[model samples]
Target: MKVLIVEDDQFHSTFVQEALVEALPEVTEIVHAANGAIGEDEARRGEIDAIVMDLQMDQRNGIEAARSIWAERPQSRILFWSNYADDAYLRGIAHIVPEDSAYGYVLKTASRARLKLALRAVLVEGQIMVDREIHRLQRRGTSLRTRLDDSEFNVLIDLALGLQDKLIAERRGMSLRTVQNRLISLYEKLGVISEFDDEVTLNKRVRALNRALVTRTINIETLETAHRDLETWLAGR
Candidate 1:
């Protein structure tokens, strides 16, 4: 079997390769790509049987690369090895994966035995593997009461960046009132506001931003992805 490793960090790439060697003897050909862009290019060669991919990279993100790879090869088997189980990353993966295709999502901190198990499950047995922690987050993600919708998430991001409602409305193409309404909903979802009367004394928006950051709901990677998405939208418009 031909296996490809796509990771920016050399140590992690080597770690994956070593694990693959130790676990899957059928993996006779092993190739490495330092970043998602290079990984996508290698994938276009149409020779890789499976891929072990990292979530974040310096050039392009794993989700974008995986989306591109799966777009061209719907049956492609991939195991996502990431350090973070952030909802944004999980949502990104959910949005792109091909229907009914077997894949895996495991944390980099997983034990070596577990990593080997994931490799076998994805490559040999063709099964879906999701870390228990990630599974918990995914379950919470399904509950509308616990998670923010995409629109609310956008407002959260804008708020986190210190953008006022007016500027957020201009950027997101919503009316000022709509922006404020979204902010109210976001504050509620984030538990940033306790009571209506507390809005004056408590900086609800700032508190909401801090909550989002602490909960891993928003981060630098999320911001970067949003910026790229906005650029794409602008170019298309």
Candidate 2:
């Protein structure tokens, strides 16, 4: 397998090279680049099977580089390397990521075993394998333990994201009453009282949801059910 290592720091570049050498003996060639600009230039020039790329580079960041690469060669796997999880970036990438490849985000602080798992995940399964902390934080805030109904969660997320119920109703093809009931159930789960008027209470819930999205504090077990349901619902669109 051919690997391209893209990083700004020469030390990190060398370290990653050593790791790749340790991980795979049969790697035909391991090319190194100083930044995403060079990485992009090299990638567009030849046949690189995979990429190990850093996030914050002097040139274009890894995400933009990955986008450029994937746009040109969607079959090539790109592993995102970073020190910590940036929620905005994760959410952004997750929004646009094409399915069916081991496109992953792995923290540089992760164990070598985890690093190996990420690369192997790309080489082996097409499923994405994000690092444990990302998953942990995401699962932490997801509220999976609350047993929220899929439709209920969908309504809640839409509400929290400030989507109009009328639009949601139109989109979901549900009656206004059905939308209201879903909101009621969500509000009940969130401990919101029905008597309040004005946007204060709704604002608080929306803030909470934003925090949940940032911290991954929603319980994933239940969140996954709704997430999958909504993803399916949105798929046809």
* Best lDDT among the predictions, by candidate number: 1
Residue-pair clashes per candidate? 0, 12
Best by TM-score: 1
lDDT (Cα, tens digit) per residue for candidate 1, span 66-161: 988999998889999898888877667776799987789999999999999999999788898887877775677546686899888888877776
User: Which digits, one per residue and each the tens of the lDDT, describe model 2 over residues 132-234?
Assistant: 8876764564455433565765566566545688867866678999998887666555545543566644554564465445443243322433344456667
- Model 2 accuracy (lDDT, Cα): 0.69
Residue 189 displacement (Å), model 1:
2.2
Model 1: weakest 10-residue lDDT segment is 191-200
Candidate 2 global TM-score: 0.59
